[model samples]
Target: MTSPRRTFAIISHPDAGKTTLTEKLLVAGGAIHLAGEVKARGANRRARSDWMKIEQQRGISVTSSVMTFERAFDDLGVITFNLLDTPGHEDFSEDTYRTLTAVDSAVMVIDAARGIEAQTRKLFEVCRLRSVPIITFVNKVDREGRPVFELLDEIADMLALDVAPMSWPIGMGGEFEGVLDLETGGVSRPEGDSRNFQGKVDTDVTLPERFAEEVELAQAGYAEFDAEAYRNGDLTPVYFGSALKDFGVAELIDALARHAPAPRPQPAEPAPIAPEADEVTGFVFKVQANMDPNHRDRIAFMRLCSGTFKRGMKLTPTGHGKPIAVHSPILFFAQNREVADEAFPGDIIGIPNHGTLRVGDTLSERADIRFTGLPNFAPEILRRVALKDPTKTKQLRKALDDMAEEGVTQVFYPEIGSNWIVGVVGQLQLEVLISRLEAEYKVAAGLEPAPFDTARWVTGDAGDLKAFADLNRGAMAKDRDGNPVFLAKSAWEIGYVADRYPKVRFNATRER
Candidate 1:
């Protein structure tokens, strides 16, 4: 029998209740006893997924977290869920993008009052590009918000997705009663707090007499669910509830178990690999440094695409081409992890990194196939990093190299032999890097504005690339991986280079 698996990521704009929704899902899944708030006061518990110190202090997820657990539905039996909670802040969008590549589907959380925001729109576009199926959660329904139809229309207009309501809110704001399940036409009301409501009647056979109007609205919304459109990725199944109250979480989980797609074959260079392929195949989508402070270790997050992964399994990392033992394969519940003896397709496992692994690298028992679709975009912001104490230069260099390998920031070596240039997608990434350098690496670092405003990786014949580099020595540089890069002072300079070096193709992102 096939393994029941559902691998998906949670995405949204900042403060759209993504983290809260994640906690509620975990609670409903029986992964944890109590759901923790993102910004709990005093000694109160914080979110499990936001385990990084920077995240806890700021109450924002700066990195993507992988969580694995199981939940059982009435009809679906036990289903394994690999949940990837991604950063909602725009500064960490690159991290989110990489995380998206590893998941089979995505759950997009939108604030009921705010509808779709900028970050949500950007992430939705990425999902559309990959044709990843999306399930919508209209959160914070206990608070006053726009009409459900307006929110649906906005999603359709802005994100170009057909909205299919799977569950409807009974009432809004202070009068918030519960949610109506469209499939069963049953009413699910919160018994009290979510913790107390656990295992209580999620679906009632008879509707309460006081919710007569809500029943009619739910019936109307229930009639709008189009299975055909939903299956095509053209439509999204929408669920409404207060994640804080955990009213509609169980229904959402049920829908996911019944409807979400299972592990699917992903495209590789030579061919697509089936999830049931005998060979063990996976791709490293993220590398995190200092998840454990004591060891100062790094972790490579690999999403197993095929076959079974045993602890200490011997596999070839495509980048190195040498056989290496997969040591202490781990499964994560936020920062907390346990030794994983075996893992299957659609499950993400963390491998200890000692400088050998890099993001986008693939590993397999066979050496022929290389996974594709993971690409690095050109940095929009450029800065020159300087070490405050020259004595700690070695430590600083090692830390910077580790961060670059993790794809947190791009380090560049200028041909002029000046200070190392730091390239980042946004200013906030640079800030996080500096903050980490001081807090984690104990290195005092400063950033100075660099002359370049844009960068591109040049691809063409070796001779042509050489000629371009020689002609533009001032603008020429090499990234951390020794890839050739051309920095431009402005758009005009990029245009001028394109006109001058017509033989070489300049790409905004490096082709994987």
Candidate 2:
């Protein structure tokens, strides 16, 4: 039998301590001895998940990271954890959205001081739409924060997620002692200073001696936590901790093993897939370019939904229907990777991409089912990319194609022009693209403001879409996937086109 598996992503608003929580969880799982801070100064000491040079310089995650580790728990034995650490910044939310399609559940980190932020709400709605089970972590309790009750209420009110306390904070700020395990009813305090707390949690210790008054006050106002509701996804079990101090992290891991569901069935186009199916099946949710600077390699990250993946197995990609060798399957720990012999359901594996695979493409041994729900949101910002050196035009085009294939940004070709128009979620993305062009591809590029501020996909009958595209050739383009799109200068332009073309539908996102 397969070991219990929990594949989840960690999500939060920017500066909510999501990266710190990711490091602590890896530390708790014994993947690494010491958890490095995201902003560590030393050349060799940085957060494992933030491996990219740009990420290290900016001190923010710009790309999604895949990490897999195994831990032995007292109740659940050895379980494999495939943790997808996603970017919290809204500018890179398109990356986060794609990563969410590859995970079974998510761990949403909420800053106790600032409850229910914009990015948090956006990511939560994505999870809710997929019915992904969520476990909340109330982070940065080592500092003064809002009342726990109020924070919980805010999550319930803003995100519509019910709250269940798995572990309650003893106190906040300077008086911060530790967390009380509600199931065991024991207070576990940090043994040392805020910088390092290495002692084992003494669950046998009673709360009265250390936090008698605080616990009493907390219990007086706290309502009963329903464990059943938590498991049902109706209520998210909340764990409070200072991730920087490593307090209550172990408890969070334990709760995840005990409560989080394991390798649930996934919805596919033709049918839903069970975890224990006989044949192997999976879908590519992410494609990354230039992971290795020397080779300029591309990797397709696939989430195995059913059966087993074997080395050198030939499986048919859903759309192509041609057998492709599953060559050199790899698993990731930050930037480091190892050849994988076999992988089970709920496992993420990377296959070498030679321009053959794409995001939302499915692969299987005996089925032609496609997985749904991977989306391409309309780009809010548009720009035209220009190469500094005209001699490197081929290199520039290749780099743009690679990045566009990775879903880093959307690339569109005008109906009548040879120039490429870039569509991005924010100005920062365009900057990042230009930076990557210089750093990774050794080509300097610049962006000029385009006439369009918004882009929408043209969806309707083939004839109608063609007529619209032909009529507005200058303002019309095709995306990387060859989908027709209309670039509009303003809301009035979008309305004008919509009113004129009654048969055509303008969509903010492309349906899978």
Candidate 3:
């Protein structure tokens, strides 16, 4: 038998305190003693388990960080948590989409004052599309002035979530008192001693006279929502806290262990390939590149979607060359990396693999299984680049190749004189590419402004193509459904010149 595990993601819009909440959770769950803040140390902060340096400096998470923490609940001695802290920015939204494939549920963090923003809606849609359970956390109640009740109402209306409070703030803003535990009816306020209030919650704190009626009405509303959800089939439960001040955090942890979906022996590992009858399968979600004085290693972070992975086992990765050692999963705890010998179903395992295993590649004991590759993403932006010194031109190519291998961003080499373009979704990504090339490969690259190209493809009737040739003007084309096609740059957009159109003809200037 295996200890129960919960696989969930922490997601939010920018500056909503998702990472801060993550650090606090790690410490409270006994995973780490010292929590590092991204702002305090710039890059000196040991890159957290999932976040990279580029993310910390920009104060934005591009890649979802994978971390595990353990806590005992009720009679269960050890509950393992495999958490994916997803990026809040729209540019790295693909990272969040890929995470949905592995996680069983999501903890949506909404800024209390801002209520629900654009990215929050997008993230919620992703969770809804996948039918993953959702647990909403309303954060940031410590900022000078905030309306607690109004924020809660706004969240419910914006997210259309049946808001249920597992814990509620005892006060508001700077004078914020404590949290009222919904289940245990306890209050734990913020103070120097707040961190010490772990599993033991105080049930006998008297509510201030001003909030007495408000608390009662709020509690009643929460009970009604929970009761209705229970009557139906939805299991999602909402909770609240000030992540910055550590208010209502312990209760949130308790709710995570108690209410969030737990890993079970899935009947079959999910695969997108044919026959649909196959053994369990899993995929590597992240890879950590570590170079130390003694050893240089590449750790593949995997999700066990189907079967179990044991220590010292050898397995072939899908769509890649040879077999690699399964040296064991690892936990980055107390500034030390230790090997975890066995990984059960739904567990996020970090195995030592030197082979080429991309983020979305799948792994399975049975050769017959395969899943649809990771979700598709549009590379909408491009930049022109040149080597700072012509002497390092060759080295720049090699540096770009290495960056591709590490999954930094998509790189394409066009015609010789063509703008040495690199495709990314945003500007910050371009900067990281340059920094990585200079730091790791000793190649300095310079960036030049490039015009944005609209991706277009031809898929309509050839008869209408005649109109296109008469004008000789090109505009971004959309499909019948209006979705821009992927990899459209390489696709042919045929514009027929006359009323009589040939089924297919290419202009001489068009690249074959």
Candidate 4:
């Protein structure tokens, strides 16, 4: 029998100590030797999970990366954990939403001082929409922060989640003695100048009398930690500690191993797919290209939904409707990878391909089954590409097409001319586009202001669409998939055109 898999994603706002917590979790699981090894140590060392020249230089994760590691539970034996770390920037909401679909649960990391942030609430809503249960980690407790009860109340009021405190901090900042282990009724604190946290409750060391009273009140304040309520998405168990200080890292891992759900059924067309179903089914949530500059490789990250998958098995992707043998299915530890001989449900496997597999595509043993719910929203920011050297026009187009396939940006060709327009969801994407063009494609390019402010995928009766397009041919374009799109100069223009053609649908979102 296969080891139970716990696939989850870590969602938080940028600079919420999420990256530190991720490295610490990997260290606690014995996936990597030192936390410093997984994270960049000095100025030159790159964090193992973070790549991309722009990401390294800017110190932000712009793309979703996967790291798989296993931990042995005394009762459950060895549990394989697939950790999907998402970009916390609001600019990457599209990517974040898609990543959430692939995970059974999520860890909501909150800054201790900054209780709830805009991006954090947005991502939490995404999880709530899918009823994806969450585990809350109130990070940075070692430093001074908002009162513990206040943070809990804010979580309860803002996100409307029943917040349960699994672990409590003693005193904060200079008065910071240590963290009280609620499970053991003991305290664990940093030792010596090195500040090495033992991550174990010292039975001999008792908590201060006043701190003990506070702990008693904290326990009685919120709803008790109920496993069923958590799994059902009604409540979230909270843990407080500083991720950078390596505090509560072991406890967080233990919480995940003990409470996180195994492979859950996936939402699909016709019917939901059960994990125990005998057919191999998975969906491509992300398609990344040029991870290896040397080979210019393209790998599709697939979240296996059901059945056992073995290398060299033929699976039909809905994108092409043709069965292809997956000869080199790879498992990831951040950027590092190894060819996987076999995988089970909830395991994320990478299938290296040229371009047949795409984001939102479903792969299955049969050609008929198609997974649902992964959709691309229309881009909010649109710009035109001006090349420094027009000689690399063909290469630029290929590069843009590749990036569009990765869902980083959307490229549309004007039906009337060869001029291309690129659309992105955020301003940061514009920076990424220019940076990637220069660094990855060796194409010096600059983005110029385009006339269009927004785009919509048009659908309806062919005659109605044809008439509308003919009337507004100047604003008409087609996406990379040849799907007709209506580019509007402003939100007002969309309403005007939308009123003109009631029969035609100008969709803000389109499912691939």
Residues 114-146, candidate 3: write the lDDT tens digits: 777887878887777666778777776555334
Clashing pairs in 4: none
* Residue 509 shift from truth in candidate 4, angstroms: 0.8
Over the stretch 182-300, how does candidate 4's per-residue lDDT look in tens digits? 34544434443222122232344456576656666767777888899999998998887788777777778888888888889898988999999999999999999999989999999
Off by over 4 Å in 3: 1-3, 38-51, 172-203, 222-236, 264-280, 288-297, 333-336, 390-407, 415-418, 451-512
Listed in order, each prediction's TM-score against the native is: 0.91, 0.91, 0.76, 0.93
lDDT of 1 at 108: 92
Question: 265 in model 3: Cα distance from truth in Å?
Answer: 8.2
| Candidate 1: regions farther than 4 A off | 38-44, 172-228
User: Candidate 2 on 183-269: residue-level lDDT in tens?
Assistant: 344444455322211122234444545455544444454444565666566877777887887877787787777777788788887
Candidates sorted by lDDT, descending order?
4, 1, 2, 3
Model 3, backbone clash pairs (residues 3+ apart or across chains), number: 4
